[model samples]
Target: MAVFSVIKLSELEGAKRIDAEYYDPEYLEVKQKLLKKKFVYFKNLVKEIIHPKEIKREYEEEKQDYLFLLAQNVRPLMFDLSEKKFISEEKAKLMPKNLLEKGDILFVRSGNVGDLTVYTGEPKKIIASSDLLIAKPTFKFSYYLGVFLTTNYGQKILIRGIYSGLQPHIAPSYIKTIPIPILPEEIIRRTEILYLKAQNLLKQSESLYSQAESLLLEELGLKDFKPRYKKTYTAKLSDTFSAYRIDAEYFQPVYEEILSTVSKKHRIEFLKKIFDFRRGIFISTDYYTEEKTSRPYIRIKELTGKTGIDESKIIYIKDNYPIDEANSLQENDIVIAIIGDTIGKTNRIYKELSGGFCSNNTGRLRIKKELNKEIIPEYAEILFQSVIIQSQIEKKKTQTGQPKISDKEIKSILIPILPLSTQQQIASLVQKSHETRKKAKELLEIAKKAIEIAIEKNEKEALDYISKSEEK
Candidate 1:
């Protein structure tokens, strides 16, 4: 079946687009439903759009406290805070146009265009990178735009405006033409509260995970240890031959330094000794399905560390697709990205992710039944994310072609064996963080759904839905 839209010649002028993709049926259908209610043009709500100038860390200062928000940090309704970078307070002061405010909405103008996130004014002073298109909300209703852009229908409008190129992107000019459904004052306030509540939950999640990482470092007697790389270094020939590598990166002195620090307090064990690993099976795209109810096909991108699985990015496969039993995910099983730029990243599976099939690009690790008493699943997740294990992974990953760490290479990586009691404590914090993050996502869904209903149905119905959903 084919879907088509017929438009008059004059109608094309309003969209300022001549491509067939711009006239997609999904875009037309969403526009019709949005026009059913009073709406505001996206351009009308914003004071102005800004693209920040590239800022560099010109001076190395004693303090680099201010966060330098990059395109990677800005996601739809959230950010990836697993890793971070900072600029000095002096550097931040030099870029006033790039400074983020509570009411500002940051849009990814290039790469994954249309993805956006709102600033809640955390840390007070922060700067946006050049890739993001910063929109300052005139009415301070940033959440309103954030919620709309995240919804199923809202995405279609943004997708329609995307320009095709070597790198696909959207301009601030195109954003001005997108329609944002006008909501009642009561509902607007409700949406704002819900978004802020979600952000707060995310903050709590980060704090808990940070505590877990700190506990591990404290136990390792590395509470104050920071590895500094030496540009001029030497390695023994026998050491390289034993490790089966000739690369200078594998011979970095920092790797031995970190390992020596860990060996001081706890015995170290190869990852293979504690957990059995299985690479996920390949499932062809022919078996893929758009139905959300189908079995979710977990890809490498879903291995979001602290935030748990990114549910929005998850794709689905046929209900009865044939897959290997070893590829099956179980609660507490660990899924790791063995390929690409995120080569060493991992995510601990929860009950919600159980029974799904993982992609070939990932590997599944389940603790040995006999070793269950030796290590907790939560602690294992925290340990891998910490520098103790990440350094090992960094050394083991293949540098040629597309970078990757094979399952055999992963199994070869060594990890510290913290005491069972200490492991349990760190595990507890990681578990709590995941649970908090889940609740925040739920609240965001309610807000997005309510807005969608307001456009498709009526304000009264949407209000009732919100009231009922909150009670549950």
Candidate 2:
């Protein structure tokens, strides 16, 4: 017989395993109940459409722009397709691909696999890249299928089968075989409604972000700005000026084009006086503690996936902890992720932080005392997320085999110095957008909770809770 030691709840530390082992039969029972209550469905691949077996070895030399369902581009799917460059027909034809239809569930097969998204907008022509799987669900329940695929039930089974080693991957055949929860008809209907609202909210968020960018560009009279180009075909050029010579990835002219537009349009002198750009207080892991308090510390991992700082997920330090210079995150201070993959991304603290401590990966900027200044932290936050700044950072970044942007590049970034009125106007719109986004997030949380409750109880109870919350 197996033996186990029991320990009190006090012995457990922040979800970590302690030396004192304990067995919980209730935990397994709950898990089994949830599993038993769950239903499983599979993707229906039966169709009359021709499935291409032969991988085209060569594509034509002519370049034709088409919608690509690549994983990187799918997260923020609202792209100006006309403005984006495309692969030459020769390069495009070599990969295994399929036509992407509206409402088709897009799943990443390799490289940070299991990133799920649904194609909503109607596109004339779209091709699924080799790394993507286009789950063409029947029109009758395509939306419902997409929702199920992204939910906890679908994701749990889908991710469990990944035979990951050096790199994680989920083959299309394996993904298609995974069981999907066959939710009740009434529950599915309610889910579809919530899902559609969520979709609308997502589109609104994207639209608002675009509006914010356009307002910034228009206020500075860069609406029709076009970047300059030297040689379009510099692939064969030899590097005589530098020690390193490689592919055209490093010398991509898009950066120069983005930089020139900002420099020529915005007044550089005015920007330097408006806001004080400061690096964050460098912190180490040694400062962290198991004890929780009123104060919350912000980390890079917490801010990466979302648009702003999530206060709920903030880690708190002990109240009596020493007040180091790095531990202070004041109100209106802009936080930017300064290390690893998300270097240029920026977020602002909207409310006063209770014992605000910032992580080393986050750069904090304290706004100048002048509240009515031409450039505020909010304005700076929006500008930092603009294409102009993104392009500039990309150009100056010294790729250590991979793209890596540094804090030096972030601080040196130039901003458009516009009239105080224009800056405030843009800030106001961004604020409203943020508010709407917050509500949308609440709705998404409700959706998740409703699904969980529905699995344990019934659809009526979950819907009642959602309705009450909305009413409040």
Candidate 3:
């Protein structure tokens, strides 16, 4: 206290006379208690996994390893572009090393930072971009670490440590130093249970997509479809064509090869029978409305992978708007993205979107009404999403800073036609898969909400129901 100052104030140059006490005993005690609650520990407890092979010091040409890559968002992505041989000297410089191994936990290091994903397949021989940290735990804490990182406490530590600025960045070292409180064994077990449920739901969605693709392939009688273009071979081009002067990527021979393959199998030509397939009209920002009594406008941002349509982000239209002016989405109509890297992505309007309006970027497809087509829109959606179709899109993708698929390209796309009965069977499986996916999403929401409530109120009061059940 100032009244009982042990040291003279005149000795301190910056010191000023104060009537108030220098310190409060009660306040100091409370501060000490809070400081004790701070959990700080060394990061070396968690281990990092590097590529198994060491980089070559010398090279016949500049050598590279499996590409080192990282996911940029909540969704992790891998680029599989190994087919084309003969990398350019300039292009080769940008190539990465460090191929990813299955079951390895991927951690983002920069940009849209701090997302995690566990790899499962043999994407071996591929590289990871420098913006990632692959963490492998010494203890059985990997699963718990994942759950905690996604939890409020984990996110709190992550967010608090972030160096705030424009294009906010969190250093990998900072993320590694984050304190993960030791959770109860019961809580850990429950977290694992929730994790597994979510994993199973994802797997089911993937399997459903696979089944639908197989059905389409069999229906088209091209069950064993393979394109003529070989990744190793250098494609020949005629000098006569001016377009040939451009880069080899512009001439997506793979797209044509696929069209040729389907043409051989189908009894009827899909191109001839179809009425129209083209990109939608792009509307300027001035035309958009903030609110309306009628339909909501859809955008590519609204799209969720495998989740289909989401209406929460939609914009409203005016009631006085003319039907012709309104961007109406009809029943069973297919919506496909036309611009940017996500081009060729497709979704079908089902019961949920019985009547809605999509964005200009979303291409609309209405099969000829007279076709009386029993062809499930879901089935067609599955076909477009198949690896076979996606491979072609990648091969043909015109990269202008960013990769994109042309409207002309999707218009000429081909699919195999199956018996109506077989199509129906596959559609049934898709419907069931959708139901499971929806339920899985709901359960995940409940689990997250429970965790939020637990953080606000102590675990005992928040999870009292679960605790009582465990006692029984």
Name model 3 segments beyond 4 Å from true: 1-45, 48-104, 111-114, 118-129, 152-169, 177-183, 230-257, 267-325, 328-333, 348-362, 366-373, 387-416, 461-472
Residue 164 C-alpha lDDT in model 3: 47
lDDT of 2 by residue, 26-81 (tens): 33333355557655435453132223233332322234655554444443122222
Candidate 3, residue 355: Cα displacement in angstroms equals: 7.2
Instruction: Write candidate 3's Cα lDDT for 1-472 as tens digits.
Output: 1333344566332453232222233323332332344233426546664422332322222235333343332342222121211223333344433445554556655544545555544434544545556665564645555655655555455554445456555665556656555545565556556555666776676567557657767766567866555454354556326333356554556656665666676543443255355455554455567664455556675555455654434566555545563357777677777667676676677665645566767777767677657467666666656655666566556677766666666655554566678778777777776777666555444444444445445555536634443354
Least accurate 10 contiguous residues by lDDT in model 2: 76-85
Mark the regions of model 1 whose C-alpha exceeds 4 Å error after superposition: 56-63
* Candidates 1 and 3 compared by TM-score, better number: 1
Q: Model 1: per-residue lDDT, tens digit, 5-88?
A: 788998886656888888887788888887767888889999988988886544332247677777767667987777676787
| Rank by TM-score (best first) | 1, 2, 3
Clashes of 2: 2
- Computed on alpha carbons, the lDDT of every model, listed in order, comes to 0.83, 0.59, 0.54
RMSD of each: 2.1, 7.9, 10.8
Q: What is the TM-score of each candidate against the true structure?
A: 0.94, 0.70, 0.61
The numbered model that scores best in lDDT is: 1
